[model samples]
Target chain A: MNTHAPVFESVAKEDVAWLGTDPIPATAYYDPAYFELEREAVFRRGWIQMGHVCELPEPGSFIRRELEVLKASILILRSQDEEIRAFHNVCTHRGTQLVEEAAGKQSRFTCPYHSWTFGDDGSLLSAPDFEQFNVAKEDCGLSKVHVEVVAGLIFVHLGTPESGMRESMGPLADRMDELPIARATTISEYVYEIDANWKLTYDNFQENYHLRFIHPSTAGQGCGGDNPFGYPEEYGFQGPHRTQTIWTNPETGIPSAVQGVSYMKIGEALAKRDLMIPGAEKNYFALFPSFFLFGNPGTHFSHVVYPISANKSRGVIRLYWVGDDENASERYAREYGMAMTRDIHVEDRSVIERGQRGLESGALKHIHLQTNEALLRHFFNEVDGRVQAYKAELEAQGAL
Target chain B: MSVLPEGYEALEPFVATYAVDNAGRRAEMRGEAPSEVRDAFYAAAQPLLAPALDYLDTKQFADYDSGDKQLMWMMLSLAHVAIAVEIQQEDEERHAHLRSFMPVTRAPADF
Candidate 1:
C-alpha cells in the first residue's frame, strides 16, 4: 500500500470555527460548585445511556443499577407484556429499600421491607392488609422512570428532558440504531474507582492522540506501526455528540504470533452481521456528558463514567460481542481485545489521577488542549453552554 | 467468579442497597415536602413497606462493623427512599408530558 497520502487530516481548533481557541478552565474539573451545576444541568437533563437491551433478553429478567451521583437505584427489567421498563428500587410502603440482588430474573419484586410485592411492570400485585391503605394500588405501583431504547442501548432521562431520546441524541440516533449492539451479549465488565474528576476521566477517551505516547506497547502496536497513529479518519458532530472513525494503518502488520492467535478472523466468520461503519477498524462516539460508544473490528463496548463527587468517580467498561464465544478463536480475540483495552485504561488511571492532583494543587490555572483534541474542546463547550443555560433558568426563577 | 474476601461477598449485596443515586439534590420530592408527609405516605402503605423493613432487620447478613457496616446500611436505606421519591415524582411528570402530546378527547385507557 502506498503511504504517500495522509488517510485523514488531524482535527484542528480552526476546523471547529465556533469553538474558540481558549483553554478550558481547570475549575471545570475540580470545583465542587461546577460539579453540582453539571449534576443539575447536564446529567439530569441529558439522555444518558444506562445499558444494552440484550442485558435482559427475556421477560421477567431484571437488573439493578445504582447511579450514586444522580442518587438513584434503578430497577430495569422486561415485564410480562414484553416491554422494558425502569423504576426506582424503593418499596413505596415505609420507604424501605427493595430488590437486594443486583441482577436476577423474577416476575415480582417483594420489598423485603414490608413485603410489598410489585409485578415486573411496576404494578402493585399484592401488599399485606391492602384494604387499609390510603394510597390506592394504582398510586402504589413502583414509580416509573423515563426509559427509551435506541440502537439496542437503553437510555434513561433523570429529569423531564426538553425533547425525546431520539431528538436528544440528534443525528447519532441513526448511527446508534445501525450498531450491532442489540445482537451483542455482554462478556465482561470492569469497574475502576479512580481518584479523579469525572470529566478528567472523560477527557481521556475522546481521542486517539494519546495512543502512541501513553500506550506504546499495547494499543500503539496494535493500531499503528512505525508511523505515528494518524488523526481520526472523520471528526464531526451529530448534534452535541461527536464521532471519530479510525483505521488501522495499512502498512501495520501484526506479528506472526498475533496472526496465529488472531481472534478477529474467527469472530468475523462466526458473526451473523458486522457493524455498518464503513472502511474503519474502530469508531469512537462520545455522547454528551459521560457515555462513550466504541466500535471495534468484530465487537463493541461502552465506557461510562459516573461522578461520585468532585474528586472521585466510577468507570465501567462493558464489552459486548455479536457471536458465540464458543469458537476458540473468538474467545482468543475477545480476550485479546479485553487485555488491550484494560492495559490502555490501566495506563490512563495513573495519568488522570496525576492530572487531578496537579489541578487541585493550584499550580496551573487553565489546561491547554492540542489541535488533535478538538473533541475535548467540543465537550467543554457543550458542558459550559449547558451550565450557562441552567444558571440563566435559575436566575429567571430567582432560585440562584 | 473469583471468591471475594471473607465477608466481601456478604457485604456486596448491601452496596448502594438504598437508592443513593439521585436525579437531583431534592430529587422527586418538590420543595418542602415535609418528612412527616413522607412518613404519613409510608404509614398508609404499610402493607407494602413492613416486609422490606423486616427483611433488613432479620436477614442474617455479614458484619462489616469492622469496616463501617452501620454507616453503609444507613446510607443505602436513605438513598433507597430518596431515589424512590424521585421515581414517584418523575412518573407523574412523564404522564403529564405524554398528555400534552396526545389528544384528550376520549377517556384514558386502563393499565
Candidate 2:
C-alpha cells in the first residue's frame, strides 16, 4: 500500500533553534499515518541490518527474511563465486515468494507455485514454456537490493541504491572496528515478543538508569547500589548512533550492585590469571534506529530490535563468545547463558508491556528525560525533525 | 542403589545412562574433570533432574550438540560446580585470607 511520499522542506535557520529539546507529539507512537510515513522515510531510506556474514558460511547458503511492514521479502545468499548477494525473494513469473524456509543451502531457488527457478547469484535460470512470454532472462532475474558488510555484519537498504552503505553507516563503522567482532562466535540467542512501541523498547536499552528498578535481579546484582555507575562524559555520537564508555573506580573493587554477581566472578578470574584485555572496560553502543552492541569486557553481545507493529516489537538478543569451540565446557556455558538471557528478557518484556498499558492511560502528556536518557531524547528528536521536514515538504508541494 | 533422592528415581536411570555416554565421549575427546568434584556436582543436581528434564523436553536449553537434553543439563550443572570449586580452591591458596576479607552473604532473593 502506498501510504505517503516523504517530503523534505527547507527549515528556516531560526526554526532549528529548538531542534533537540522540543517535545515530540505522542501520536508518533500510536498513529497509523506516522507508521506509513516511517515505512518510506525510515525503512526504505535507511540501511537496515539483515544478518551476520557467518550465517552464509559456504557458497549457495541462503536465508530468507520477511520485511512484513514493507510488504517485501528478501533472500540473502552466498553465490557460487563466494560473494554475498541479496535479491527480492520473489519469482518473476507470478510474484511468488521463492524461498519458504528461514535458512538453508541451495544452488537454486524454485518457486513452489510456478516451478520458476533462480540461480545462487539471483539469475533467472529457467522458465517453463518460454514461447508464451516476451520476457528476457536478464530482465526476469530477481530484483537486486543493495547489500554491504561491516565487520561481518550484513546490512541491506531497499530504497534508491545511490547512497552507498559506507556513506550511510558513516563514522560508526570505523568505531565498530575497535572491538574484535569478526572473531566472535555466536554462543546463545534469546528471542522475545514485547508489547510496546518499538521506540520505547529502544528507550529502555539506551539508558541504564532503569537497571536497578526494572532488572533488579540481574542489573541490580551487576550494576546498581551505593556507588552507581554512570556514563562517561566522553560519550561519542555519530549521526543517529551513540556510544558511552563506562569507567569504575579501581578502589571500589566492584563497580555496582549489578556487577556483583557476573562481573565480580569474571573480573576476579581475569585479574588472578592476568588475562584481562588492555584498554577494555564496559562499553555500550546503540546503532541508530534499531540495534545495540554491548561488550562485557570479553563477551560481545548484540540485540536486534524488530518492529512488528505499533504496539509490539520482537527483540533478538545473541551473545557471542571469544573462541570457536564445540567443546562440552563451552557448550555447557552457552546453555546457561541462554537460560540467563531468557530470564532477563522475560523481565524486560513484562515491564515494556506494562509501560504500553500506562501510555494508553494518557496520565502524563510527556515523559521526563534525565541526563542518562539523553540518547533516547536525541533519537526522538532526530525522528521528529525528519517527520516534520517530510510533512512540511509535502505541504509545500501540495502533495499532503 | 540405597535410597535415591526425592526426584532421583525418575532421573537415576537417565543420569546413569548419560554419565556413561558422557564419560565415553569425554574419554574420546581427551577430557577430564576431577572425579570427587564431579560426584559432588552430580549429587547436588540429581534431585533437580526432573525439572531440568522437563525444561529440556520444552527445548528451553540452547542446542550445543546433538545429544540428550538431560546430559546437556548435567554438563552445565557440572560447569557451575566446577567454577564454584575453583573459586574455593583459589581462596584456599590465598591462605583463606580472601574469605575473611569479603564474607559470603546470601545473595538477594531476587538475584
Candidate 3:
C-alpha cells in the first residue's frame, strides 16, 4: 500500500490497504460451480432488495417477481390487514404458476390449471370439487416467504436471516429513510439483461475509476478539478455492506441550455421539500449482496443486479420520486433526469460485456486491482468469505 | 381547431409528429426519427425550451386546453432529443440500440 495520507481533496491509498492489494482469482467470476455455491451461501441468507413498498400501496395490491437464482417465483402483496408479505407464486394444487399479469389489484388468486384459489394473505380460499384431495385446507395454503419492509423498501429472505436489514444496516438504513425514496409515491424505472456475472455488473457501479474513460459526457463536469478520476472522497464499511462518499462537483458553470433548465427545475422541486441541502446525504450505499442506491435527492437512482446464470445477470434501475408531478415543469425535469442517467448507463454496457468475455476465455488466472477499486475488492472478499465457509460446512458433513 | 397554440404557429409542422400521448412513446420517437428530422427539430425547438415551459407553468395540468397540452408533450419529447443533439451526437445512433433493452416501463410523467 502506498502510505500517502492524502493531501487536501484526495483519498489515501493506505486507508483501504487492509482489504489487500493482491490479484483476485478470475475463476470466481466465470465458474458455474462457484456460482452455485454463492446461490446458497450469499443469496439465500441475505435480505435481498425485491422492490419498493410504494408498488403495493394498499390492501389487495400485488406484484409477481421471478427470482431466477433460487428458481422461485415470489408474489408480494399488501393484505387486508395492511401488512406486506411474500409467498410462493405457485398454487398448492399441482403447483401451477399463479398470477400471469406482472402486477394488479385483486384479493384472491385462482389457479387456471386446477381452480385452486388462495386469499391475499396466502390462505386457501376455495376449490372446485370440495374433497377429492386428502389434505387439509389450511395445509394447502401458499408457502409463506420471509419478508420485511423498512424505509419504504421491501426485502425478502429465502433462508433464515440472522438479522433484519434495518438492524444490520445500522445508520445506513436511517440515512436512506430520509432520502426521497422513503416518501416516494411513484417511480421511473427501466430494466436490462446483461451478458455478465452478477458481481461483474454490480462492480461496474461500485467504483469510480472507470468514470472518466467510460462516461466522459456525464462525468466531465461532475468529477471535481483536483480529482480527475472522480473517485469518492471517502470509503466506509458497515458489516458486509459498503458506502462511498461521491465527489461533489464545485460547479464549472451550468450545463447546456435545456439541460441547465432541467437541473434548475429539479433543484427547485427538491428545495421546496427541503431536501436540497448539502451533507453526508451525498453518500451512495452498496447494500450487499447486490443493490446500490446512488442517492442524492436531486438525482437519486437505485440499481439492483439479479443473477440469471454464471455468465448472465439482469439489472433493474429506478428513480424514486416523492409524488406525482404538480405541473409541466416538474414533468419535464423528471424525464430529462431519467434520459441523462440512461445515456450514461448505455455507454458502459459494451465495456462490461467485453470484460466478461475476457474473463470467460480461461486465459487469466488472476486479475489485478488498484487502490481505487477497493470497493470491488471488498465485495469479492465478502462474497468469497461466505462461499468458502459454506464449502467448509459441506466438507465437514462429507458432502464435498 | 389549431394543432398548436396561436403564438407558437412556427411549430405547427412538428405538432403532428411529436405530439404523442405518453412519455415512453415520446422516448421511442427520439431514437426512430431520421437524422435530417432530428436536425431540423433540434434547431427549431432548442431556443423555445424555456418559453414553452414558462407558458405551461402558468396553468395547472387540469385546466390545459388542447394547444397547451400539445406544447407540453412536445417539450417533454425535446428533453430526449436535446441530449442526442448536444451530448451524444453521432454516438446516439449506437446508444439507442442498447437503450431498447432498458425500456421505460414506468414513469411519473406517464400518469
Candidate 4:
C-alpha cells in the first residue's frame, strides 16, 4: 500500500472559531488537499444514501451507483430469496467494473474484462481456469458492503461491519420513519454537474434565510408574508446527522403569491397533503457528509452531493410522489413538481458557481453565517472533528 | 375550440401512449391504482402529446454529455408541467361551483 501520509491539521485559530457563526473558509471548497482529507475522514466513514427500495423492488432487480471521487461503484441487488444486498461493483478476477449499465435486473453479472461471473447473491458462479486456481468459488465471491434499508430508502456504509448501519445512522432512521416515506413513489430525478465544492452546495441547502431573496417568488410568498417563517433553535444533532423540525400552520395552503418563485413551494404543498411526514415538514435534515433528505406529507425530495474534485460536484435530486393514481393527474403532478425543483436548483447552482469564483479571488478568506443556518455550523464542526479523529487513528497506528 | 391545433391528432396518441407506458412504470413502483382511472388519465393526456423523436434524433446524447445533466433538466421540467396541470385542474374543478352562478344577460333589454 502506498502510504503517502495524509496531512491533517487543525484549522487555524481564525478558521476554528469562524465555523461557529460564519461561513467556512472558502479555501476548503477549492483546495485539493482538503478534498482528499474529506474523502478519508468523511465520505469513507459516513452513511451515504444509495437509492430507494422502489428502484430495486423485485427479487432480481438491481441498480448501479457510484460515489465519484471514492472510485466506489456499488451494485445494489435484491437476491432470488428477496434479500437486499450491496456489493462492490468491481469484479474479483481482474478488478474490473462488473456492471457497466446504470441500472437493470439480472440473474447474474458477467465481467467483460475476464469473463468472470457472479450470481445475484454475489457468489462467484463461474471463472476461467477455476481448477487451476486454488481459490474456492465460495471464497471468491464479490466483496460486500454494509447495506441498510430505512423506510424504503437504501443506505450503504463503506466502513467496517463493526461500525454497524444502525449505529452509523443513529437517530436518523427513527426520525425518518415519522414521515410517510413508505407511500412515496419516484416522480422525477434531476442531476447537475456544478462547478463548485460539495460543501458549497450543502451550505446553500442548510438554511432558509436565502428564500426571501434568492427564492422570493416562492418562499417570500409562502412564508415571508405575515407569517414569515423561521428556523427553530431547537435544532439537534444525531451522530453525524443534523436536523431542524419546523411546523407550518395547517390552514394556509402554500402561499400562491410566492408559488412559482419560491424553492419551498413543492415541499410546502406536499406537507399540506399529509403525504410527507411531520418531521420533514418545513424542516431540513442534513445527513452528514453528502446526503440531505427533505420530508413532507405529500412528497420527499433528497439531494446527494457527490464530489468530483475540490471545485466540482455532481448534485442529484430525486423527487418522490405519494398517490395511488398513476394517471394524467399524477403525471401532471410529478411534472409540476419537477419543474418547481428545476427552477430552484437552477437558482442555487448559479449562486454556488458564483461563490466558487469568489473563492478564487482570495480577496476574502471567510463568509458570515446567520444564526438560522445553525446546521451549517454543525456540519463544519463535524467535518473538523472527523478529520481530527482520523489523524489521531493514524498516529496511534504509527501510519502517520 | 381553437381547432385543436396542428399535429394535435398525431400528438394525442403519442401522448396517450407515453402516459400509459409511464403510468405502468409508476404503478409498478407504487401499488396499482384503479386501472380504469389510469387508462382514462392516459386518454386525457393523449391529446396534448408532443414526442421528442425529432429533437432526440438530431442531438447526440454523448456529444452533449454532462453526465445526464441536460436530460435530467429536461425531464424535471416536463415533470413540473405534468404535476402543475393536475393541481390547477383540480383547483378549477373544486371552485367550479363559484363560477356556475355567473348568469348570462342580454347586452341590452331594449330591442
Highest-scoring model, DockQ: 3
Question: How large is the interface RMSD of each prediction?
Answer: 22.6, 15.9, 1.2, 20.1
Q: How many clashes would you count in candidate 3? A: 0
Question: lDDT of each structure?
Answer: 0.64, 0.59, 0.86, 0.60
The model with the greater DockQ, 2 or 4, is: 2
Better of 2 and 3 by TM-score: 3
Candidate 1 per-residue lDDT, tens place, B79-111, comes to: 223222422233333322322221111100000
Candidate 2, DockQ score (0 to 1) = 0.06
- Tell me the lDDT of candidate 1: 0.64
lDDT of 4 by residue, A1-400 (tens): 7754323231234432434654667677687877888888887877778888877868889999988877899999999999999999999987899998888989899999878999988899898888988778989899998898876778887876446655666777776766656555444566777888888878888876766566554333334223354334356678777776653533345533223322343444454555544345665677767787776543357788888888898887776656432222233344444445544555567677888888877877876666666677778778878877887888899987
- Which TM-score value belongs to model 2? 0.73
Residue pairs in clash, model 3:
none
Runs with alpha carbons beyond 4 Å of true place in candidate 3? A1-8
lDDT of 3: 0.86
What local lDDT score does residue A200 receive in model 3, on the 0 to 100 scale? Answer: 91
What TM-score results for chain B in every one of the models? 0.23, 0.30, 0.93, 0.24
lDDT of 2 by residue, A158-255 (tens): 88855666565587677565555554534345466667778887787777676656655444444522335333334556676777665443333333
Off by over 4 Å in 2: A1-19, A185-187, A222-234, A247-281, B1-43, B46-72, B77-111
Off by over 4 Å in 1: A1-8, A222-229, A256-259, A263-277, B1-111
Write down the TM-score of model 4's second chain. 0.24
